[model samples]
Target: MKKAFLASMLAAACVSATYAVAQTPVNTNNGAAAQGPQLSADEYTAYQAVITATDPAAKATAAEAFLTKFPQSSVKSTVLEQLVAGYAGSNNVPKTLESADKLLQVDPNNIRALALETSLLKAQGDSATDPAAKQSAYDKAADAASRGLKATKPAAVADADWAAIQKQVTPYFYSAIGIDALTKKDSAGAIAAYTSELKAVDVAATTQPGPVLQDTYFLGQAYYTSTPPDYLNCTYFATRTAIYAPEQFKSTFQPLATYCYKKFHGAEDGYDAVKAVAKDNLFPPADFATSVKPAPTPADQATTVFEADKKEDPTLTKTNIADREFVITNGTTEQAEAEFAPIKDKEVKLTGKVVSIADTTLTLAVSDDAKQANPLVADVSVTLTEAPKVAPVVGADVTVVGSMASYTQKPMMFTMTGGTIEGKAAAKAPAKAAPARRAPARKR
Candidate 1:
């Protein structure tokens, strides 16, 4: 992909870098391209030699000699453009970049030079060890690409030719912009720029193992990491990239797709259908977002439980400790108040893992969800009547009897007073584990 793109860039630079060289009456009284001032006879001969060189290396030398000898000539910018193209064609990396930089000094909005600068600088930024240098490279690349996008077509270039050049370089412009946004943690900006880049290229180009395909995965990551996250979009693009990736790379991309799918749909049972659909399309199909069944949000879960309750037998019962906690913690102001009304000041006995313990008060994780967090969270706090001879172990499950008191919803904790600890739940002996349950049970 690298060879092909740079080759295309060299080809474009060679053909499209031409200016009004050897025109009948070339003038540059202002040290820029103009048509009024006639070229001196000797100056015309020097310019002719530069254009007539055969080898790229020889061409570069001749162009440099012409520019140095005639620095104030009207054709300075024109000769620098040729020098940049010649170095690019010679496959000289440092020289190519140097000449392109010189060309930009003369024509700041030169599209060919900007495209080369953006691509090369971005490559350096990707592998840089110094954070400050890395950031500066991407910043400059993004700035150059931005200017390229707004560059005007010179009149000497025909409309048809300029359109073709625009098509060739526009993808780099958007890609450079996307990389800059991603480096700064601007996921929304990255998503917008990358989406435009994918649309600007041929659809087939996105399926190949190349910059476009890699950027497709980056787009999915941007969506997956965005605020509040668009899991469905993350699943779509990630699945698409996985379909085209080689076997060694397939595992890397497939896992991210599965993770996002399980996060949104709550299981992997229907994921094969998502993969099948993704294999045929670059972007998600029109109805793909709606077709995938989404798991309930926290608010939705709370609202559903509240709506389904009846006065005759409420879901917020002393026996239904986990359900009561779930609804109260996740529900809205009115819903939480309703859930808490019946349970407040009520003495309830429940078994939970001791998360933290103290002489006066300690916390416990009553619900399974809280217990499952990497570092367990306390959903229920108990104020003990007195500390025990031996303090309760941090991770041991025990039965606690306490009168429920105040609660906080956002952090989701329930405090109880005048509490006593029953003995710890028995620790399970090591044994052969049972068959693993499926995705929703995992909840991640």
Candidate 2:
């Protein structure tokens, strides 16, 4: 969850010639009229002294002094910009922010100022513990980023430098907006912002793995958490992230990618194909299409099991509980009769969890190979010889000895008669009710 940092870009750009103050040609007409702010001899001397300082600390000191003396100077913006650069170079975050704000007051569209402010605000928002404060900071950061995105290149900046600045700051701007949207639980908004960010940058060409990879992961998460989750896109982006993620992150993102792919495809059959596609592409192919197949029905699964088991033992169809249950519940009428024929009038010992009781009939979910079938599909209906002394509680384990009387297949039930609870425990006392407290007296 580490947020991207653009402080280095801000610091470098501000001090470099890209953001240097515009220098006007010196006029030798000292005794004549001046075109712009004609600085006095001392003021001009101080300006030169500030700009020519060797180190950032000395530059900051000189710039502050110049600004203190010439508060209304025409070059105030220039001095403040220098101070911003100086403070940033010194790693003085508070003063750097303060200087950037001062520069913004004079030149609101200043790219360096806007970039620094937006990045700092986002960093603060990321670390904030209070939800309201965090949202407010992120909201402000996103606003600044929006304005920065529209900012025109400065007159003094070269075309190449401006392009480089754009390439660096634009992604961070979009990321701020997307992260804020994610915090607000606006998954669609986050996806839109992140998509715009990826389109703005060549993520596959990025040499650094931090920002682009992380944003790609976030984009996948946004898709996953959408109203109706876009599992296909989620799988694509998540797999792409895994392709570029660090070794530690590979293990983390791989499972998410696999799960989404499996959920969308209904099986793992084509997962290797998806991963191969993701390794070379940032987005899904234009011709991409996939369909989710429904899981097999219980009856279909039972038939599959029966067929597989019959390969080993031909007599399994008549003796296996699963095979018999499948035939009785899901097979044709003739098949049900064939399976039920041999067991008629035979005494069987059944062990299962009690599902429900009505008068003398107990519905049970018969267990097979130690695993019980779902209680809702109760397969045993035992008719007791007589009403017992105590009624058995639902979900209690019990053994019944009864003769198989009959069965119905559509709503499958196996009727047994002459049944009795082989062993029953004494019923425990009901839990005592907690004492209620008196209401507190109303204040006078």
Model 2 bad stretches (over 4 Å): 2-36, 129-133, 153-161, 203-207, 290-444
Clashing pairs in 2: none
- lDDT tens string, model 1, 151-220? 9987777799789878877887888788789878899999999999999999988888767777788789
The CA lDDT at 25 in model 2 is 29
Model 2 Cα displacement at 242 (Å)? 0.9
Q: Residue 259, candidate 1: how far off, in angstroms?
A: 2.1
**Top model number, TM-score:** 1
Candidate 2 lDDT at 210 equals 63
The residue-level lDDT of candidate 2 at 294 comes to 31
* Best model number under lDDT: 1
lDDT per residue (tens digit) for residues 341-373 in model 2: 767888877766678888888988763422244
TM-score of decoy 2:
0.64
Q: What is the lDDT of residue 231 in candidate 1?
A: 86
